[model samples]
Target chain A: MSLRLVRIDDRLIHGQVVAGWLRALGARRIVIVDDATARDEFLRDVLTLAAPSDVPVEVLNIADGAIRCIELAASPEPVFVLARSPRTVLGLRQAGVPIEVVDLGGMGSGPGRKRLHKTISISPDELAELRELERLGTRVEIQIVADDRPIPFRSLDSTH
Target chain B: MGFGQAALIALGYYLANSPWLFGLAYYTLFRPLVAGLLVGLILGHPAEGTLIGAAINVPYLGFISAGGSYPSDVAFAGWVGTTIALAGGLNPAAAIAVAIPLGLLGTLVFYGRMSVSAVFAHWADDRAEKADINGVAFMNVVPGQILLFVISFVPVFLLALNGPGFVKDAIDRLPLWFSDGLVIAGGILPAIGIALTMRFIFRGSAIPYFFIGFILFTFSGGSMSLVVIAAIGVALAYLHLTFTGGLAPKSTEAAAEIATAPVLMTSDETAPAGRHLTRGDVLRSWITWSFFSHANYNYERLQGTGFAHAMTPIIRKLYTTPDEIRAALKRHLVFFNTEPNFGNVIHGAVIALEEQRANGAPIDDDAINSVKSGLMGPISGIGDTLSQSTIAPILLALGIGIAGGTATGSSIPNFAPGSTGNVLGPIIYVALVSVIIVGIGYVAWMQGYLRGRAFVTDLLRSGTIDRVLTGAGVLGNLVLGALAAKVVTLYLAPTVSIYGAQLNIQASVLDPIFPGVLALGLVLITFWLLRRVSPLWILAGMLTFSIIAAFPFFGPGPQNPNDYSYQACTSSLLHKYAPCGVPPAPSAAPQASPSPAASTAP
Candidate 1:
């Protein structure tokens, strides 16, 4: 039950997953790491309802999610980890979970963010944390859906 | 027929390019129904134009152009389809049959343009790396327009000038069985669209909502307006959200509480925040991006070059050093795509972040890119569903129904084909859609800037979007149900005589239970088949079935214009309650001959 893929998508469980990503990843379990979604029963119900019936979905806060990810590291079953922000993925990685790759799926345009890609908008703080994660040997890639080729994380050649 | 009409057709094609240049929605300008009305007005036959447009548009109701993939060119179909239909003096149904083949051929132009656009994107990339902002903007706009003009103007000018005679000749030569197959095929094509929509909206819990819409419209005798259905749907969705406690703890309170919430494993780094961008700067970027996001769309980066082009104004404002500007430009020049209207908020937020980075925040390329990558998928998923799938369909159906009017009589004045009210249908649709898109886009962009990162988080937590989606789902399902009942035309022609009593299968069996039961069943079956079989296969099957069935009373040719109505047995095969092969005389109705004399002998 090792973490198969860690994805960052603010909308959480929606069509890109149920229709596009699930088939692409062929994963049977989804663990959503978000404090707000985990505590809110209504959100949890909605998320579960939104996902396909066959994919067992569980929503947990960062702490429990990290523990779950660590526990699943030993199992043969592949587990998909999802969170709303890069911070959560960083949190899971810092918690000693061996996440090999982090996939950034969606982040909406908001104030104080820049458009890096069509579906992604990020704040400076979020960007810093992602760079730190990349430096820590966790490869970060941005892909819109399952079918798309993942673009490797690239940074400005600051030496110039 | 004349230079002016040809010019108008060419103009419609040119306007279709506005999605890239003027930032006007692609849906508004190119949709066959809407384009038809515009073309009709130019030709001094708005009513005829609309009738033709509506007929041509029906087959493409479920059309989607996600990620710049043009499966069939609706714009080409609408402009050329209406032109050919009107010029050839063909009935709208027959015109639809004519237009489909043309639309498929238009895909060649689409791919040609897409392939050409990539060269420009590469040129823009070279300019961007050199920090030539003006050059990048020029590449985004100029070459694309030149290419657009050549593709749209040449074909339409020639087609409108010389092709009408050819169209008439071709249509005349087509066998009745084949022509009839086209009409039947057109009537049943909406099922494919409805099924595709069902695939998008279907979830286990949401299934019941679909039925509610279906049952309500079925029981209403097909008289209920979509507006009223939408209003009721909104209320039901609200209740569902509130009763389920989906919107709880209030988003503001949640945002405030969650700020202090503990992360068990992650280290927290507190970066000092400072104001950098003015509202004017952010708005400037939005305007630049909205109009030119896909101006230089290419196979290599999609919207990547446009992304860099949009950030030019902000990049200039913040970074004075050439290296800084170069870094900023390179950062944004990456692959990106999303539902443009609802997804612009991400742009707004990123502008704010860039401002902070200029003011000494530790933001680098990866952070900005990472955020964009994360949001693109989910926002696009939601945005595509909201804008393209749900809202557009509802608005179009309303417009089509209004323009079409009631089956038995004309409630609105006949401006041309049916009534002056038909014009109002498209008018109301364009206005309503324009207002909602602009209003929502402005709000999302501003909110992203004002609230910063917390804005999106708050939006999801507020449950407004979820509630709105649920409501829209309810409304969409009901409207589709109503549309299926009223628009999709499929019926049984067989009659059963038991105990000396003649009972019509459609009238006595299906009509009493619900209007359009056969149409609805066909739609559902198509939906099921869509899951298992490819769309191409289903389309082929529908064409085959329609043609084969033409051997009976339902033989392919022009169906009575009146036959496209919701009344089960009146218009189609049962010409006047007696099925087509059966003479009005009950004595002759018992004959074994199923073929109507009008059917072309196979």
Candidate 2:
């Protein structure tokens, strides 16, 4: 895909995306892959309204997201891919979508999750999936925003 | 008057740039509603200033600056609009008309300033490479603020000092019919603002809430205060959520439980943590974020430069080696953007992480970045809804109501322009906003610092935010409805004399049907237009309609200062419950007075 960056952020699009990352990356469009949000008409509308007027947004389920990514692989404009969890990205990779680098942006704190970065709180199950993706040769790195140098996921301690 | 107004304009300059010193909440002091009141105080007409500011603020209710792109400048419109209106003796409506154009023009300066600030950001980037900490800090605040000061101060200063005279002289020269028509236009124009806010607050199911407010005010004879209505709205919303159960999603309850599951220092519990940074350092960084978070906002790395600047004190305190210092600066200089006040928790969590990393914690730079990246969006969503959409509009509406009381059918005139009511509106608004926000913000920052990322996540995921938003929406609807009933005045004075019975059309026919019925209809019509047509079109159409409608032939003329002609014309339109308050002795010289202003209350 012509995806310049693939980020895992629960909040698929927000101030950091519109005001920070989009400008820093200079991406033309954002493709948010979250099944629940894609089906929710209300949420989809809210996301579009929240987005900056210039940049277009596409909300799609995993299957559609994979197809769109494949189509965008040859498109002229670079696309920024985002999902709420690592498993979603892993699914795309398993489905024959080429994702070399996955930027870990934000995974919110909750039960059964250990705090990794100030922004990332991950469950053991999710961590195993990410590790599996790393073993499969995806350069999964923890880079919250564009300015920071991406730290290799291998460097982080997987143990809770 | 000239010197005082010039000084107030200088204050406006300081208020606009004061984010670096006073914190971002101080930015509200520059908003038109509040600024107008301050200008009024300076010009010996605080009430008039507040009334004018509130009116001017209506058109800009939905104004937002997403990603440093602005549609208009509220500070310029509010300060200059209030000053010109009060000084020139124009009503609130005419002042809004004048202020809107000025606000649109102010956008040029905003864009110009954003472009110039990029130059300053580049200079900071150079200093970052050299590890010149002090130089980087200066690049962030000094040059950028100077540009902001000049742009904000000069136009407002010149306009406030000189524009009044021109406005007064121009109005004096205009034909009486045209000036009277302006007053009519001013009265009708507030509908546009009321309608605009409706568009923002209205959604599925929420639509009925608006009409409930309208019906309540109409049936109650429009005497209730906004606070009382708000209380009623809150109770009703709570009951609706409790009984209906379907309106608010059920997941919110489960989310709330998970959110408040208690503070877990999961990974940090095992890490060897010691006090490396002092309380003073943490507070310093917090203050810095408060002031300079958006100071160097640009197209690239939105708050990147400002974030680096905020971290300087902490970085200097922690790192001794040049490499460490340079790395820390570059690390912070990454992309950062969030809602300023509520978003301070992220800064707090970062400060705690920095302290641990400095004290031999295995935490690498990526951990810190992830924490910020993760928390920024969720925190920002809560912050934007709470601060911008809910708090601002609710408070502004209450302030406007206090200033502009419900006096449509009263014998006494609608609260005079510079009266006590008008002055109190802005003062109360400033007080409430500062106390509630500043108090909550301070506690949250400290909590985030001590508790780290877990605290903010818990806070964001808590269902309290959703419930609060729902309640606020209900309150906003009720208040908007109350405001329509109180402020958006429209009536027809056409009377029919059948068989010499001399029937009053509005009082006899319309009052029996509903009070504020025409105003409510006008607001709904404007709301429909606002949805389909551009605001500029609605504005132009209203101006044309009001002026044409104000012609003497269209209805009864106002109480003419020179003759008894208006009294004779309107005598048939007088209501049975009240005597026409026209003075028995008609004076020789003309004075300005409109008999029962049909389209506008003030």
Candidate 3:
């Protein structure tokens, strides 16, 4: 019936989200929106196996995911939406998925990426996408677990 | 106390934090319980050291390090905290207060090590490019371990050398109320660890079982031990499983349906049977992974360099030419991180692909890399939940219970001095964890190698893992509830004046309704607060609350007038505020005997 959370984590469906967030948010289902994962059959199977038997997981590309999110909003079940990158979340929002707030769970360090918070790294491109999402009226917050204090994206030192 | 002992403990700490000995150090020696026993042995006061260590370990029972985020450094708390407590002759409660700040400071050391070791990962990448296999392996262990040793040893050594005298002086200068507050804060701090773990494992349908464990222990009037409670819990879990369709034939039918469902086939299905890797090759690779998986753990590539090091044996066995070897090494040198034990399946499947590729299969670089990346996240999800949240915590609860003397019988007021628990506690814990890690790691690795990619689907379709997790949930909640009752200490120091007679709120009001009701309430409130606030804030609040509550009228005092002595009161913070009429002779022997009766004071 409602989307409980929309999150961005590089390591999707890992311990924190499954054990910590799902129960904390009371979401019964998971819908991972990512183009690469949606196209990869092996990844899909692994993810499905990774989830608890009771909670169903749906992997969809951005275009299909946007449509699915609208339908999920109409349903009675609570859903938790996950994506790997800010770009994916931006695409979903632009495609008309009514996202008001975005929770950044994790983004590991890699090439061309600068540290944004604890264990969260963002590239210039991803930073621009997050900025664009914020401009569209979505509040962005960085929180690793449900219990941790959520740090506003805007509050972080962005001069670097 | 001496230079030799200090240096020896520092060396022990270095080895415990190092990646050698198949990573067993992190599981065993790194625990404060064991660290206490080890430090105790070195200091010739093994029992006293262990008691202090066990007390400090109580707050870290829920410790979990996932995705390279460590909430607190237990190793620092265990090694350095235990040493200081022993040398300063501080009791367990005050020692916990000291240990906590050190644990927070130790996080700086952890982050520093993680960030700086990234340079070694970059160094390994260069060696892989040059086909320098030895160089790559060297970079993984040599430089990273040197950094770890320096960071781990020097600080611990310095702290052990000078920390005790400094802490003793500080405590000597503290006002009576403030010292009492530190003890009160120590009693309340364990609630945060329990609450944090509750966030992860406590959920709908399993919530009631926690209260069941708590009530069972509390109402038993200290007659029930943890082992007895655990037995009842296991039986209850079995019954719950049977009635909840966990053992029903319909679930098996559903599992069968999933097994027969149409599933996509990967490259393993069309294997062109070229060169096959021997069992020895896979075993060697797994051993390498088990021992050195986090040897070069860093921010840039988390476990990338370690992954390449693990694959060297397989790559060597499969590839002969320099170009082939270089390509194979470089293929696995990309970003990868997962739960090392349960994530061994990825390693096994990749080994199969590499073996097939060497024999002339059509598998490309993308196929192998995709398998690693795709499976890492999902495997880590299940693995971290099972290993970190479920297995480790359950085992730790038992170990802590035993070491703190709460498991044998509930008569002990959790970690009371002069009641140093049996040393067998740490030994049993180490043995059990070693068996599980080695056994599970070997089986998961071999299963993945033998069944290839299909193993994951088969493992999930069997329905056994679900049952195990379900059973673990019930058991984990029960033990945690029992642990909360046994470990969390919250005694109300305030008294209410009713009808011209003073009434102790803790005894007359709370205990008559339910024993440890305040402790239970504190844990639940903390659990609720964890949802909206960080643990650090909760800790700060508890400390401030305790300190402010330690005013002359509000603070706790000795329960019995006879049990109080000025020397005993001054030495042990528990009885410091007891109203002794007159100071005893200076030579009055200290009453170091057990004061279990003090908890029931009027």
Candidate 4:
């Protein structure tokens, strides 16, 4: 029933995460959920190697991941499930995946996104997804980098 | 990769897909597999087509770069080489030898496509300001891809399907003069590329060190490897920093800037700016704190260290003031760029310097400029070592592995597990990308927000970053050494078994220091001939040398220059797959010559 921290990073297994994040979290597994990821065999193999071998990684798609939420409830291993978009989380919740919280990570700022923090930003669609996650009982937060604290997404929702 | 094949592919692709766009000879689209398959299916060897196609893709693994620069034209080469290898009754090596010109034809294709791609970029440009993001993105990605496919698909198909045994007949009848001319010309063309590389990185503080690394490693004689040269590199990098690094006053400017910025991060901040991580910050962005992933982030507008400044929100929320952010930014500032490798902070640090100024960080104008000033030397060093010294050689090594030892494919002495080898293939990319992305990411985040004046001052206290580079250099040297022995220049060609004719090739202008020191003589000759010589001259020299060597007047070996061909010598397994505009390749392996490269451990 525990997911260490929910992050949305495209490059799931990289040096910064392995050397910096893993060191900070004292985590055991990195769970990735992305529909596109499932289709890229080479990417999957490469990502698996990027992360720490000692700390296992399970790259799953949103549907399969949500269905396997029961596995999370069954197993005690601390995990971090990374999704590409907030909607994926909403889909997970609707699919019966029980998640307690979600933290925002690096999202490359582009159209539809209003800058929330220097490293943090979001779009209207994303804001709605956050609201959807919160409605599903998952606390939504606005955190982009590792050296920061939790700020409720709702606090800045109106201005942004 | 002969000239005819490239022309055929370009013509075919354009005609087949878009008559408006000549896909002929464009490297990205030059699909040798399609060509080979088309040829084999027609020439009684679908298996051969598939075999050649698979083989041609090898050198391509490491083929990508920031720019579209590539060395092979697998499309034509694949079609023709496979066809020739099959119908000409030649082995793969000979087929490859015959295909070199075809691959070379793609070079012209590149020049042509660059001009066309510029139009597409301009087209994308018009859409970008209009806020047509997807349109712009598509323009950037799709046009080039479509163009490539067209150019590759048609020409390869036509040449393979229609081109005849002319090349084979040429092999038999093309007089020694023409044949010898090709061999000579082919050997010299690379000088143009080398000169381009050298011109960019030949100067600055790190130049002498490059020489030291080059000479010492080359001098050591045993399988000169990166491990060896990198040892000297470690010493060179460390000494350069220790003796000359801290002297710059930019640190003070950086300190002032750090003192100005604030680390007022939001709660969800999880960027990796290495300022002291607060417990709350750790708890909040725990997922990233333990790094379990990666991202290919491009702050298109945030050039330089603006990326580092992007972490401003996180830093501000995590810390009370700019001190922590400053510290983090200072640690990240360096003359880093990913052309050589990623994870380099030089660009990020410079961006931070810019942001500090923009945010009124009070860095002395002169002090602020130091970051930029400090970059040229380091950048130059990295460019030369990574791109010219290491990378070029590795390309050649991969070329050797894929092309195999025999000039003739059938005569290949060894395929020597390249990509599948622990180092030559995918691992090279993984190692390179991991190093690059994390390095760049950290620098970007730091420059974004973590830096302040005090923070900048303390971070560069001469002990921390210096120690890191020195230690890393040492480790790099060790690792590069093992790689040199095992991965880079480890191949040994079968020595010439000559009769009792006194060839006199080994003249000791300065008496042979070691027994049969002809290898040393050869190295000196190549160096002298190459030293400050223009590439054209170098080409001329090589042609002259190859011609002299190929003269039946001189020897019985296949003397025709056109005799050497290749399908995709560059597409060997020794390269990494592309993650960005370029594929991931660690520093290149030095060129394999009878003379050692500078891979002798320091």
Off by over 4 Å in 1: A1-160, B20-22, B202-209, B215-220, B239-276, B408-421, B500-502, B552-602
Q: Which ranges in model 4 have alpha carbons more than 4 Å from their true place?
A: A1-160, B1-104, B156-166, B175-520, B554-602
lDDT tens per residue, model 4, B283-302:
23222321211111112211
Ranking by lDDT: 3, 2, 1, 4
On TM-score, the candidate that comes out on top is 3
Using DockQ as the measure, what is the rank order of every candidate, best first?
3, 1, 2, 4
lDDT of each: 0.66, 0.66, 0.77, 0.40
lDDT of 2 by residue, B1-602 (tens): 56866777656745764564456434366567777778777876666677778777766665545434455677778888777777777666567767877887777667677667767876887787888899888887888778877877777778878887777677666554455555556556778778867755665456778778877766776667666777788787777667656233223223544445454232445445544666788788877877777676654455768888888988998887888888888788766667777777778788878877877778899788866765565467557656765677677777777666334322221322322245677777777777767665677778878887556545443445556666677778887787777666565656667787656665677767876677788899998776456677787787777666656654445542222234334422221122245343322112332111211212
Query: Candidate 2, residue B591: CA error in Å?
Result: 7.4
Tens-place lDDT per residue, model 3, B238-286, is 9878888783221322344445654322244554554557789999999
Sequence-dependent TM-score of model 3: 0.89
DockQ of each: 0.11, 0.08, 0.50, 0.01
Kindly give the stretch of ten consecutive residues in candidate 2 chain B with the minimal lDDT sum: B593-602
Q: Write the per-residue lDDT of candidate 1 for residues B208-298, one digit (tens) a residue.
A: 7767776666677655665676667677767776676653422332455544433211112332443355668777878887788777665
- Evaluated with lDDT, which candidate comes out highest? 3
TM-score of chain B of 1: 0.84
Candidate 1 per-residue lDDT over residues A93-146, each given as its tens digit: 899888888888777554476656545667888888888888888888888666
Interface RMSD of 2: 11.6
Proportion of true contacts reproduced by candidate 1: 0.12
